[model samples]
Target chain A: MPLVDSVLAQYFEDALKRADAMAPDYALLWQSLQAATYGGKRLRPALVLSAYAGLGGPDPAEAAEVAAAFELLHTALVLHDDVIDRDFKRRGVPNLAGAYRSRAAGRGVPLEEAAHRGQSAAVIAGDLALTGAYRLVAASDLPGELRLRLLEELDAAVFASAGGEQLDVEFSLPGRRPSLQEVLQMSRLKTAVYSFEAPLRAGALLAGAAGREVEAVGTAGRYIGTAYQLVDDLLGMFGDEELTGKSNVGDLAEGKCTPLIAYARLCPEWQELAGLLGGTPSAAEVRRARNLLEECGARGYVEDLVECYAARARAVLAEAALPAALLAELDGLLERAVQRSR
Target chain B: MPLVDSVLAQYFEDALKRADAMAPDYALLWQSLQAATYGGKRLRPALVLSAYAGLGGPDPAEAAEVAAAFELLHTALVLHDDVIDRDFKRRGVPNLAGAYRSRAAGRGVPLEEAAHRGQSAAVIAGDLALTGAYRLVAASDLPGELRLRLLEELDAAVFASAGGEQLDVEFSLPGRRPSLQEVLQMSRLKTAVYSFEAPLRAGALLAGAAGREVEAVGTAGRYIGTAYQLVDDLLGMFGDEELTGKSNVGDLAEGKCTPLIAYARLCPEWQELAGLLGGTPSAAEVRRARNLLEECGARGYVEDLVECYAARARAVLAEAALPAALLAELDGLLERAVQRSR
Candidate 1:
């Protein structure tokens, strides 16, 4: 973990230096990106490093670069995700986009113009982070064949995520009606492969693990990652803002059709709550909608779904015949992943 | 050329097939991407192949893959560029984002929501193309070391372009008053490196050309690529829409401060034309602004600048002692690239 942190830090330092030579404005982007890299759970990097060390990878240093790559990839995706969702804040403060927007506003730009500038900055920032991630792997000291293999895996992860993201946008449109099954699939593809499956498998591959073991870890990852997203949905709706660093009403305002919403759609209270979401709902409206969802068992239903996937992940790990250390570590991670309030 | 075309076609065919399995809506995204790939002059790929073959690369097949990779990268950047600029059309037709917007409109979604969906789709589609470009190089039949080197170069190109894009966005903000020198720097960073230098150097590298030769071609590329963008600016203002596949008044509408605008700032007529830009100027206003720019010598100034850069490019190419065939091909490209009315 420390190795990955150092790699990421060094990477940003070099990037910042290069950007400084370009222009002050460009340098600001790198500075903002460095800030965005902080405060993350490092879940993906943890999976990469843990899998590698637990499976007897010879060099933590090599795996560190790969782990750091995953962290960069995560940052890239989150930046773009915010742009798509039109979110300007993360972790209870101004994100890269919001910061740029505020910068513009401070300079007397109109609010709308400032907002557009912020979003455009975000798009460029994300491109940097995304390509930077690949550069890390491509430029690392790893063996050529091994690096190529890892890149292929990374590509598949990104490809699936892009598809998943498009599907998410499609599902969010008013004219489309996505079933709960489709929602779950979107969640898996959008969150699971890159966050968990690819990192886990890459670590295993780097450790010279057998194909069967790599496949097993990837399968386990799919379940655990889906459960993690499900928990995130719960936190988005019910968790305290102080703990979650997100407004509980934000998802309701966006009318995000999470598993909770999907379940609520079939409930008797749907008519009452349906109009409150996917709009600029007030605090009172959000509260009423939450209450209706709870009364209709939607909240309970999503929680049950999380537990089900977590259990399945546990089952896969147990039967995968992984090293004792890795199995225990994964078990601990799974519990914390799904149980976290944020 | 046919080889590159086939590679791209196969790439899209496979991509579309995969998207089809995801969902109908997702598949539509791939369809849009395929359409977006059409009608390009394939300048980047041409540079790659020309450099490779002209330098005596053994296998055109392998270089074709790398060339195709450049095309994908171009498409990726274009998609993101449209999102940043909030443009829905490309080549005089609905682009990936516009197509999605139209789809939503057909389904009775509000115009605003549909536009948002379309933009989000472009973001996702760009991600796919960006990563897919890397995949092409990583998964190519080229030797591992060669592939890794190409990826590193590609990474540098993307990084520079990202920085350039941010700078462009920054300069467009009301508070920024960039000089002509600064504008030229942005143009070179945003357009020259990825579009010209990288491809030429990459092709030479693939062909195992000497470092000095690669460096020479890269220098040539910087000049030519910058000149190409200058021509694009001229087309954005003076060229007919039917010929250019873009609105002639778009640059004025966006208030983009190109080198011409930078020069115009010092002219007597600037005050008369300034307010007409960076706002939604009416057609008459656009005409008046155009007249003012021409009267102020900004248009002729940019044209002279293009000739200056193109001449420098020709000098470098002539002195580089490149193979006769590649040199002739590059000269022909430079002429068409800078002189095209479109």
Candidate 2:
């Protein structure tokens, strides 16, 4: 196995053990936590570790705990995000709310009451996961100043992401279409910085990287994160459900105003597409909307944007004063992130 | 002004400035923040600074930022708590939700949408306050280890408080009334520890106090906190509205399962009170319920509990090895905290 993979496996084992020990009686909370944590692609942790390696840091084992911390935080966000978005499934399985609702029904509660209870439980579970992330970082063997800095970065990312979520929720309302630039800015703050830049910067900071090296890693992270989110937006619209393990049409169903949707709005044929985009559109309407997106060249436009970001990511990586081997690995990850089917 | 008050006033000014600079465009967010912070009695920050001084530590100014941090965190909790309770008013003024609801109406939005937008904004505002608390602590001049410890304490308090809140919410539902002991435990975790112990301990830790001294302060804090909560219960049931700034009969009307209510549940003669307190009751019904509480000796029972905790607080203060002058002030503060009308 690769170094990052080996370290991540051990990290997950330890994290799961710690989570289990935290709540012995809350069996459902434990199970939901395991489901959220165990199946992730580990992109955030890999970014952190890669940044550390790029900064001349040795021993992937040393970065494993921090990696675990970032992953725990991400999982916590996902669980809460699903609840906030009213998502019923993730990775083709019942999400936390769905699982808890089912459990409550088995105990003979009314449906609405069961779902309310599930939401309440999910909120606390997310809080516990968030606290666990901090606990992991606090309990790490890292130096105190470094730990504090890492925590500060984590805190900033959380706040920014939360603000982004607020904007995303607001954009769902009528007459509130944000400008495309605003959308990209929100995406960068909400997804790119936390999902990519902050974690990588945190890892590099932990490895004592300073000045231009740190700045370069952050730049690389931003490019890669933008590309990753662009791909995610594309997949949300057009990916196969069997492969992506998502609703495939979920974002459209939710009326999410992604970059592709925003571009579609700018086209001359937007009036037709807009009718099919928002509210409860039929399956046929959704198919037509997807077809409209392709007809208007939105899909191609977004794909081109993703490629541009991916190329920018490569250029940034090339400019970073890091080891050739680490640079190559990071370049590969960026390409794979933007090109992956699922 | 007393040393603790002087320090807190200065700290509050600086912290507010920092918060303003962080996000200038979010004016309503800042106003809600100022309302929550400035409306508080400054008891928590007083406890912290006083504890630092009680430990014979000089330079109380050094603890100012952290004192402000605790106050900010406490305010954030209050904002969220008000929302969770669907409270329209707090501290005799419109709450964040109420204010935002009015603003949305002024903007010509529909009622339901406005209310939801208000709730969403309040959530984001509370989150911002929560994040601001950590930022203050992290950027303080305190030593890194001390700062980390303080942050950890605050985080743990938040988790415990959230857990307690969950329990409180659950207890409000039919068929889920926990035992009186469990209620007290929840109260201690939710209100006492964070509101009293953590702040004091944070101060002591920052002032270079030893473990034993910190523990002793915690003991004193627990006693004071419990007594304070007991008094709060008393105020909720029987205090005059003008003095308490809350409906004297509000708890009874809302079917709040507080300590007094729990004690009433155990008494056969108080069965009438239970029926009245089962759900939303009329103002007249609330008045009659209050009379029943007094008549059935539930009020007297709570009074006795308050006295016991207050005496325990005084005894703990006497036992703590601290400067005599600081001890005297803390004792006076504890007495006033329980004895004050509002």
Go through the candidates in order and give the C-alpha RMSD of each one to the true structure. Answer: 1.9, 4.1
Local accuracy of candidate 1 as per-residue lDDT tens digits, A61-134: 87998899899999999999999998998877888999999998888889987987888888888888888787
Q: What CAPRI-style quality would you assign to candidate 2?
A: acceptable
- Per-model TM-score of chain B: 0.95, 0.89
Model 2 residue pairs with clashes: none
DockQ of 1: 0.71
Error of 1 at B316 (Å): 0.9
Worst 10 residues of 2 chain A by lDDT: A19-28
Best by DockQ: 1
lDDT, candidates in the order shown: 0.87, 0.72
Q: Which ten residues in a row have the lowest lDDT in candidate 1 chain A?
A: A333-342
- Tens digits of per-residue lDDT, candidate 2, A1-342, equal 155455445554564464344333243455567667766888788788888887888777777777877887787777666656656567777777777677666767678766655655565566556656665666567876787788777776776676566566555666777777667766776688888888888878877888677777888888888888888888888987667666667788767889888888889878898777656778898899899999998899889888898889888877776778768877887878787633
Q: What is the TM-score of chain A in candidate 1?
A: 0.96
Positional deviation of A192 in candidate 2, in angstroms? 1.2
